[model samples]
Target chain A: MTTYTFEPRLGTDRTALYVEVQQFYARQVRLLDDLRAEEFAATFTADGVFAPSPGLPPAHGREAIAAALRAAHARRFGTEPVRSRHWYNMLRVDPGPDGTLVTHYYTLVMVSRPWDPAPVIAPSSVVEDVLVYEDGELRTRERRITPDHQSF
Target chain B: MTTYTFEPRLGTDRTALYVEVQQFYARQVRLLDDLRAEEFAATFTADGVFAPSPGLPPAHGREAIAAALRAAHARRFGTEPVRSRHWYNMLRVDPGPDGTLVTHYYTLVMVSRPWDPAPVIAPSSVVEDVLVYEDGELRTRERRITPDHQSF
Candidate 1:
């Protein structure tokens, strides 16, 4: 059996920073999953830019982010009661210029309803986020998402 | 909207340890998903105990763990060409007595094939793990998995 070494891109010494970012995502994803648009948007900076994908227009600013999320929620679920979860793994954190953190991770969106026997897993995607400290708290300054299917 | 705070059980001071464990799982889960039973078991201590669920018997020691994993993989996949991914979220890490770390997290097992358009999401589960440092490396000493459906 071949032994695989766990070598992180940013090295093991950045555990504290990595954990901080992970916790940030933990809260951000939950807000989005719960459809708390305002709260979700608050996780980003006032002028944060979210480019969902190459084909879609990016949402700029917290207000636009909140509106886009609410619109997407309404269009997707409508009146149906459903629970959506965003699961992340294989997170990579790197230092960026100007004291920002560049993070990359795979996200799997799971959607299920009370009557459903199993949850539906959306096509996985990789997200690149530029995080910055705003008012002593970490927040997303910019985000770019690339779907797995589209990457190839 | 009511604000939700991200209060971790271990507090923010323990970010370094939390990230260390998260990285550990990143590698451990891949070994299991890829059917590298021996490699997966190596992430545990020599006398690690894994209780998969209440209905199943626990596997004690690395050898037993590896054998159990291999048997389960063969039973589930057989000759089928399927890909399995384990996604984790909502991880909580706490300090345990005797210089051990306790971790709790939710796990979602996703299975898919080359021909399948969407992956199937298994019932989510909560895993409780006790980790200890062996030879300056973190390893799992005990793990207990509780399926979400069985909790109630």
Candidate 2:
């Protein structure tokens, strides 16, 4: 995987924070591709909560969230290593009142198998996330995806 | 209209133009309310075109387009008053390639008779319009409405 250079700020040290988000995404992509335990654990914080924009329930806690992702991946992509794509449109990213929360606007489009060759759903969404910093590493305290379109 | 004073950009001139859009809206509202017209015109320039962001057909032309709107008003609204509450978010009215085209972000939440409380089937939409200026009047060169949520 090639390292991309995109520095989004949520207050505090910019460089370290930027690397953290990218690394998180990298681990996430690997976990999604492999559907393995260790990779998933590495990707998300222990208390990570995931909410797919549409057609899924709110997945809370690392194990639950990771399991949900794995199940969904298997259901769609099947046994063959699932290959996925991510599209994020940058609208506005700024520090929220909590100081750690970064609010941003984005549109996420995802496709899976057995359902159709084409994408299952694509929705424009906005998220507010609390980026927690501990031991020189940044992880998400909470991430809330709001008012997503439901077509999947 | 209580004439709320905003910046020059959001003044009477713009509202007047929007009022014109409201008039265009009225034709359909009137139709839904069981009204007819001998001749009604909402013309865009030759190069005018509508962009449907979500899942609506985009149209162009003068008489054809006007007739289309009239027909739509007839079918969709059908002589019922549209209790529309619209908020025009981003409207950039300036000279276009041919004449004038205005681009804006709009959220229209309205209720028409027979469907007074149906959970807003047609959710608030994001709209962009290309307009034509003629004889000190604004005409729609093109009108595009991209729905926030679409079934398909």
Candidate 3:
């Protein structure tokens, strides 16, 4: 294996930048867990694309993605949303070649269904995100959620 | 949604250390791809534990893990090893509470079957690793591989 290097934000104290990126992700996941559709849409760029898996077509644009998320959440939890937590770990931030930030992490979603008293942990996945820093904020350009195993 | 923080390494130029940990992981994956069973076993600590998933029992100790890996590889590829590549991306290194190094990354395995001319990408997963620094080298103390989805 060749030496693999991710020299994003090299020669600088990018600790603060990394922290900000981490916070951005944290906020995004929070919005998702809370079912804040509009606010979650604000986290992405105007033309951001969110791909759930390789087999399915991606939702194009932030608006479309938000609608999809809202529909999915509503279908699963109904009007009274159940308590859920999105745990994101192993956050890594790197600079893309085209003046964007690339971040990746693992996400574990835990929720207490209405019928069950105990929390149920859903299947987890690794998210690869391409983010653009605009107006001093990070926005998603493209996000790909890849599951760990083959579904079909 | 509370403000989450990842203060694993604060106010330190941890680039060198991250690079070292990445190298250790790189070496481990390389040995596995090359089918060097004995050498791959040496990358782990004497009492290291390798858990492929939560549903399955873990392979305790480095020797056992290595033997299992070797047996699996032999079964899949037979006596003659075929070409395969394991791509590890988005590597994140953090400091563990007990002075060990914690690492997480996404791995995508691509292999060429004996009858197939092209390589097929296998299911990918996130690997969470606990590593110890011994004799100026990093060794895997525990590794848990969590798949992104359920296979039924």
Q: What clash pairs does model 3 have?
A: A148-B148
Put down candidate 1 lDDT per residue, A36-136, tens digits, no spaces: 99998999888899898878999999999999998887888898776777788888998777767889999888776654536777779999998877666
Summing lDDT over every window of 10 consecutive residues in candidate 2 chain A, give the lowest-scoring window: A1-10
Whichever of 2 and 3 has more DockQ, that candidate is 2
User: What is candidate 3's lDDT per residue for A1-81, written digit by digit as tens?
Assistant: 111232444435576567656656645765775678778888888888889778778888778998888877777778764
* Candidate 2 chain B lDDT trough over 10 residues, lowest sum: B1-10
Which candidate should be chosen as best, given lDDT against the real structure? 1
Q: After superposition, how far is residue A138 of candidate 1 from its true place, in Å?
A: 0.9
Better of 2 and 3 by TM-score: 3
* Per-model lDDT: 0.80, 0.48, 0.71
Task: List A-chain TM-scores for all predictions.
Answer: 0.88, 0.59, 0.83
Docking class of 2: incorrect
Report how closely model 1 matches the true complex, as a DockQ value: 0.20
Model 1 pairs whose backbones collide: none
Which is the better candidate, 1 or 2, if ranked by TM-score? 1
Candidate 3 lDDT = 0.71
Q: lDDT tens digits, residues A1-152, model 2?
A: 11122233434544334445546655555556555745564444566667764345777777777677677767765776434654333222334443453534333435565546765433334455555544445555556664333321
Q: Of the candidates shown, which would achieve the greatest DockQ relative to the real structure?
A: 1
